[model samples]
Structure formats: structure tokens, C-alpha cells
Target: MEVSRSMKDIQWLRHRVGQFLCVGFDGLTVPSHVNDLLTTHHVGNIILFSRNVSTTEQLIQLNQELQTIAKQGGQELPLTISADQENGVVRRLPADIPGLPGNMALGATGNAQWALKSGQLTAQLLRHVGINFNLAPVLDVNNNAKNPVIGVRSFADTPDMVADFGEKFIQGLQSQGVIACGKHFPGHGDTTVDSHLQLPTINHGRPRLERVELVPFRRAIEAGVDALMTAHVVFPAIEPKPIAATLSRRVLTDLLRQELGFNGLIITDCLEMNAVANTVGVGRGAVMALQAGADMVLVSHRLDRQLDALASIVQAVETGELSQDRIDDAYQRVANLKKARLTSNRRVRPWAQLIEETRTLQHDLAEHAVTKLRWESPLPPSVRRVAVLVDERVPVMVAAGDNHSPVLLADALQAVRPDLHSTVFRFPETLQQVRTDDLLAQLRQYDFVLIGINGGENKDYLEFVHQVHAQSILNVTLLLRSPYDAHLVPQSTNLLALYENTPWMAEAAVAAMFGGTADGALPVRIP
Candidate 1:
């Protein structure tokens, strides 16, 4: 029987190469190209995105299939299935899933315990869905007001605030046996450009970076975070070159490894992003990233790009351009992480009840984070004839597959004040289509005007807000994404930054408007 079992063992899988390539599957069903990568190369880790998800059942089946395929191919250790479940904007989980308020909401609550609960709850949900790794707890200190990407996704503006929440989040996730990866290492927080679109350069010197950007990363490391994801931004202060952090050995090996002393696996942000790919293509970028000490290269989105990246890395190894020792070291590090973090047997819970419990926690965070920015005169107006105008740019998440939740301020306010008479105005479908004269006339009908701006970076939204401000209408601005938008609004505007337009958060913010309890500290300073 022993001889027969030995004979039945798979052969091709045992010789699996390119352990550094941590690629993502294509879509809802695993494509042939993806399977070929997993089977031929024995790629151990697979990241999931929203496009790949439809329902929980499908996701669970996909995860099982991927793992079974790995096992069948003779790749021993369990394949690490990871997802971006950092609720609020980065959530890949289905809309029905218990999406927690984002990091900024957690930060605004000013409670470490809540953040810990968020992490633990998020881990439990992902584990149930057969996911072992969660790329979450965005540890970047969002100090820049003009930052396009790391808005409400970040916890706070200050290093200490982000550190406290991030550490607790790591502790909570790891305690439940889910690997927590602190993301966008060396900080992508202060960039005006989105890394997905292009390479953002951070001009902060060592002292400035140490004071803000590196603070949360260091804290996350000290708290024993299992993984650190690299940012694609160029740190001129550290590297003095145009090379992204993903490709800079000086940034990754010297700064992060030597100075910060991070021993955990260092994963690169998606190589498919324009920042890296545009400069050197995803294939070359992957090799460069691995050479720069990245243990895993995430080539997400395009399967062709992913395969090309894997082939490039393999070639680099074969040519001695990337030493075998480096490959082995990365493999060992990733293997150790998988062995420690992957749950041999996950504890099953009543799915319905678990979601319910998580939803309760979400409510707690939203209520506590609903802060009162200005409390001068009569708040929660005695006469509630409210008018809400939402920016046309505020995306409906269900349709866009984006993390941003739609602005439901009108509904939330109506929920809080049952007798309140309110109407919501929307911008036209096309850009610059909303009739300014008609909008102003409609606003003039209401006692108090409420303008909703979604990400706050759109010039049209800002233009509208300025136009409204010019009218001398008693309108208060509600920033639905980041509080930093308050900087762009008129100084006289009574802005209420909800951080996220999540349902519970919208309700909580509206409650404050109607005198419920506008009760959170400003996480980021607004000019």
C-alpha cells in the first residue's frame, strides 16, 4: 500500500518553479491560462477581485476548485487565497456581504477596540468564504488633502492615530488566523495622482517621511503584520530616481528591510497598474520588483499580463540575472507565511447570524464616527424642509463594481426625521449637462440646501459647490468621500464629511444634521 501511494504521487508539480509569482485568476470561472500558471509553475497564491465575484456560493466554489487543482498538481502547502476585503471603498466582497465602514470611519470613531472588532469580523467572514489572506488595514497616513486614491481608504491623517488603529487591526486579523497585509508600503498617501493611472512621486525627505508616511508602516510591522505590499510611487527623498518603490532595491531592501527591519513577506502592488507597467511593462516590472526583494508579484486584472510576468521572472532566474538564492529565499518566506496563516480547519458559524453581528458592529462605527464639525446655531432643524443635491459623479457601486457607495443622504435624513419633507436633486448623466439656472431655482425652493460631493476631486463638483456658495443660499456641503475635500470648499460652507457614503454612515451623518449627535473628531485637517 505504501509503494502504491508513493507511485500515485504527482511528479510535474514537485518541480514547480517561480514561487515568487503570486497571480490572480481571470474571472468568475478559472480560465485555462490561469490554470496553466497554477499547475505548471505551482504558483501558491491567488488574489481575487470584484470582477471574479458574483455570489458567495460561486466564490466559495472557485476557492475550493483552485485549492483542489493545486493539491492535485502536487503542490503541497495550501494555496493562499487572498482578497481586498477592506470594507468601504476597497471591498471586493459582494454588496450583500457585511461590508464594514472604511478605515477612516474606524479612525474617526477614535476607538482601537472597534478597529480590532472590524479586523476580527472581516477575517472571520473571509475565512468562511475560504479566503486565508486579506490585503487590508491600509496603514498609510493620509496627510495630503489632494490625494486621489488613499482618501477614506486610509484610517487617519496623523501617524499616531493610524498606528493605533492599524496595529489593533493587525492583531485582530492575525488572532483569527487570517494573514493581514499592511498595504502600499513606504506610503502612497500624499500623492495627488492615482498610482493606477501613473507613477506618483512623493518628494518627502527622510525626516518628513519618518514623521508621517513610515509611522504607521513601522507600527504595523511591530504589531507583527504578516505581509507588506509595496507602493508604485517614486520616493525621490529615498531613491532620488524615477524608479517606483516596487522596483527600487534601495527603497525595498535598504530602507524597508535594513532600516525598518521588516522580516515578513513583501508583496508588490499589482504589476498591471499603469505606474509600473507603463514604464517597463508588467513583465519586466515583475522581474525588477522580485529582484528588488519583493517576495510576491501581484499581476492582477489581465491573465496575459500575468503569464508574461511569470515567464519574464522565470527567464530572469534562468539567466542568473535573478539569483537562485533570491528565488529560494522568497519561496521560503512565502511558504512559511502560508504554513502559519492558512487555517487547517476553519470554525464554522451560522452565516446569517455572523452577518447580523458584523452589521451591528458596522452601525456602532458609523454612529460614533458621525462627527459634528460645526455646532453653532439650531442643528437638527425644528422645521425640516431639506433639499439634497448629489454630484453626478458619485458612482453607483453595484453598477461600477467600485468600492464607493452612492450618496443616500436624503433617504438617511428621512429615516431619522420621519416628518421631514425632503427632495434629492441629481446631476444629468452627461458631464456638464446639469442646467445651472434650473439647479439654482430648485435650491431656492428649500429652506436649507445640502450638496453632496463624492471623492471631491472632480472640478465639476467643486465648480457646482462654488456656484451654490455664490448664491448665498443656506446650503451645507456634505463630503461623501474624504474630509479633505473641505479644503476645496468655500470657507463659509458648513461642511459635514461623512468619510464614506456607506448606508449606516449616511444615516449616522443625517442623524447629526437633524440633531442626533454629530460626534467624531476631524481625522484630517482641512484648510
Candidate 2:
């Protein structure tokens, strides 16, 4: 069938409708080609990745340029700029912004007020850099200790615990008018694989899912989250098809929309992820995602691919394969989101007040989260010597491949106790190499032995803990990266799970170790 003149009028309709499609750009500045693309295709939103960001001033300039491009293209609409500012390791503005602890750290304190403070600090930092949206407050319940990616990112292992912390975080962000997105819906916290590399499958049926994974999301929705991002994992038992949640209507439309009644915007994780890109072409993935009920398709990279996908979507609508009503619905949702953002008074409050509030809450929460796993003897009146065994796999922001050896811990200990003598032992490989003679010698010398498990791989850490059966020694294990390693230490040991391995956590650990304050228990259980 020959297309009608009205249908062929792509340029006229592009201004009003097609601009809802968001795409990324190549350079730091919005190039002329990007302006042309926006003018010609009406692309609406832009997502900033690590490549697009360098400093706070640069990010603000880039966002200004993008808005200018939108205006020059004859579109008066405000461009939505988003970034992954989850704090800790996922921070984009590391230099200017203060590195705060992750969600699990707040949850560990079992305090809702700290979660609210984290949100406020995060939102203030984001607004300073002109970012309007934060894809954060990962609502997944980290029930599985073997979960590779979502361990420390999640607030806690229990749904109620996660919900308690996440609800406050969402409210804190939204209270400042920054769009808070609760993500990886239905959930990604229980999977053993990372979605960036491949698709993960969750075996829990609907009932178990409602009780565990779905609880936090449900509470977040009820608490009024501004947006929701779908996961790239598949629940084979629930959806049967091998498609990720981003492309599955059973997960997105039927479950999240109809069942849970979430009326806010729905966004895909990222089209560039292997879970979507490897299975289907970006063009088809875009079409399916819209058909599956996504308000925004986040293309982290590959601008040309996103343009092609947009063109394909336009063609589908013209050919009668896709309904114009569906297109209109998504366009309206996007426009509404932009309109809401424009009207929002997201102004910065006093910086000193914000910082003071953040510090006060952080100190309080850290004090509550420092758990005493095992204390063999009563508190000694005088300290003698201490030895700290540090794991080498934890990720440092400045250093790429390094370990959290005993040196860092000993320094922290010394900072708390000036008179205490400290010794450091760096474990190059497995703990098996640390001979029993060496272990016994160290055990005999030190009044207390504090072991720090830096990251996820804890086979050696656990074995080393079991071998050192010293009753006089207080085994204080600090979990830096993933809290899953907390289970490796015996229940009798003095264990403290800090969730994140950031510099701030190191400082918090120092304060909590010397009885300066009482840190709370583990927010999540270790089974």
C-alpha cells in the first residue's frame, strides 16, 4: 500500500511526536551533527556516561549545550539529562563530590534518617552538576550471598529491610525535586551473574517473588518513586521466554503496571547491555521495548544505532504494524515527565547546612552499624599489640589493581589507639601460603587479630578464619566491597559489614573500632 501524504509527512510529526526518543552523543560538546539530528528527528533526552563526564563544571557545560541544541532545533521542550550517581564506586563526579557510603551502609545502621540524609546529599551533588535524574536506590533484595553484582548495591537481604531504607532514600531525593529511579525491577539482587556481560535467570515463582524480590519495589512504588528501570534478567518460571525484563511484557506491563499499579515512567536499563543487544538488534529491541511498555529507552552509547531504532519505530507506526495510540501514549508520558521537571523548583539550599546534616547522620549511622561478631574476653583496660590481615582484591577509586592489606587497617587502628603497637602482613595469593608457624607466631604476639575481607571471593578468607582458632584473639572482620563475605567469618568473631569499600568507610571503620561509638547490627542476615 502506498503511504499517505499525511503519513509521509515525517518532518511535521517529528516535532510533536518523535522527539520523545532519547539518544547519546559522541563529543564533550553537543556537535552540529547532534543539533541536526535533534532538529531532523526530534530526539528528546540525553544520558551521560563516564565518557561524557570529567568534572562538575564540564558536566554543567555539557548539559547547557544539550539544552541549547534542543532549543536551536525549534523544540522548546526541556531536555532530560540523567546520570548513574549511586555514590561509592558508581560515582561520576568523584573529584568535587564527597564520596558517601552505599545503600547497605545506611541499612546496616537500621536507621531511616540516614537513608534520607544520603538521598539529600546525593541529590545536592547531582544538582550542582546540572543532572536532573539519578538511577539509584537499587531495590533488589540481596538474598543470595553468591550474587555477583548486586551484593553491596542492595540495601539489605530482607525485602522489608531494603524497603525501610529505600523508601526513605526515594523520599529524600524526591523531596529535593531530583528524579529518583528505583531500579532493576522486578529485581536483580539474587542473580549470580552480571547483566552487563549476559542475561541472568531467576527461578523463583510469583509467590516467592512477591514475598522476597517484589516487596521493596512495591513499597518504593507506594512511597512515590519518580521512575522505575527494568532489569536485564529473565524469570523463566514466571515469563517462560528467555527475554530480559526490559523486553518482556509479562514482567513490565502485566506485572509492574497492571498488577503492582505503578503509574510513573518506566525505563529500560540500557540498550547497549549484552542482554538486549546480543539477543536482538537495537532497532527491534527499541520497538519491542516500547511495545513492552517502556517510557524511555536508555541508550548509553551508540548514537547511530539509536537513530536507526527511532527510524524503525516511526516506520512501524506508519506501516500499521504498531498503533499510533501506543506512540502517542509514550510521547505523552515523556512530555509529562519533561513538563513536571521544568515546573519543579530544584534549587540548591545552603551547602553548609546540607553538609552538616549529611555528616551528622553518617556518623550516627556508622556508630550503629559496627557489629561485634565475637568478643572472647571482656574489654581490656590497656592495649598491647594488634595485627591486621587485609584482603587484596578490594577496588580503590584511584588505584586499579590493588588490595586492602593489613597496612590500611593497622593505620586505621593506630589512629584510634595511639599507644597500640601494630603489625601488617600482606597476603599475595591464597591464605594457605601463610604457614601455621607464621600464624601461631603472630597470634602469640598480638593482643588482638583483626581480619579484613576486602571483596567477594572469600574461599581463602573463610579457610584462614577457621584455621586461626585463638580464643584470646578478637577476630574483627571488616567487609569492604560485598557484604556476602561476612558469612565466611565464624559467628563468634567480631564481624562488621560496612557494605562499601570507599575511603569514607575506612574512616568510619576507624571511628567504630575503638569503642568511640556502637555501630548497629547487620541490616541483612547471612545464611
Highest TM-score against the true fold, candidate: 1
- lDDT against the true structure, each candidate: 0.80, 0.73
lDDT score for candidate 1 against the true structure: 0.80
417-524 per-residue lDDT for model 1 (tens digits): 778788866654422565777877777877888777775546775676687788867877777777765666755347677887777788877777666666678787
Please write out the lDDT profile of model 2 over residues 1-527, one tens digit for every residue. Answer: 34677655776665644555666666677777677767777777777766677766787898888777777877767777787777655666535545676777777777788888788778887776778888888898988877766776787888998998889999888877788999889999888887877889998888899899999999999998989999989998668988888888888889989999998889888887778888886778888888888878877667677777777777777787667887788888778877876556655777677667666655666666665555444446465777767666554432111324446677666656678787776564534566756776667677777777765455555556666644455556676666666555555356666666555566567666665565666766777
| Candidate 2 structure, TM-score to reference | 0.85
Worst 10 residues of 2 by lDDT: 395-404
Q: Single out the weakest 10-residue window by summed lDDT for candidate 1.
A: 7-16
State model 2's lDDT: 0.73
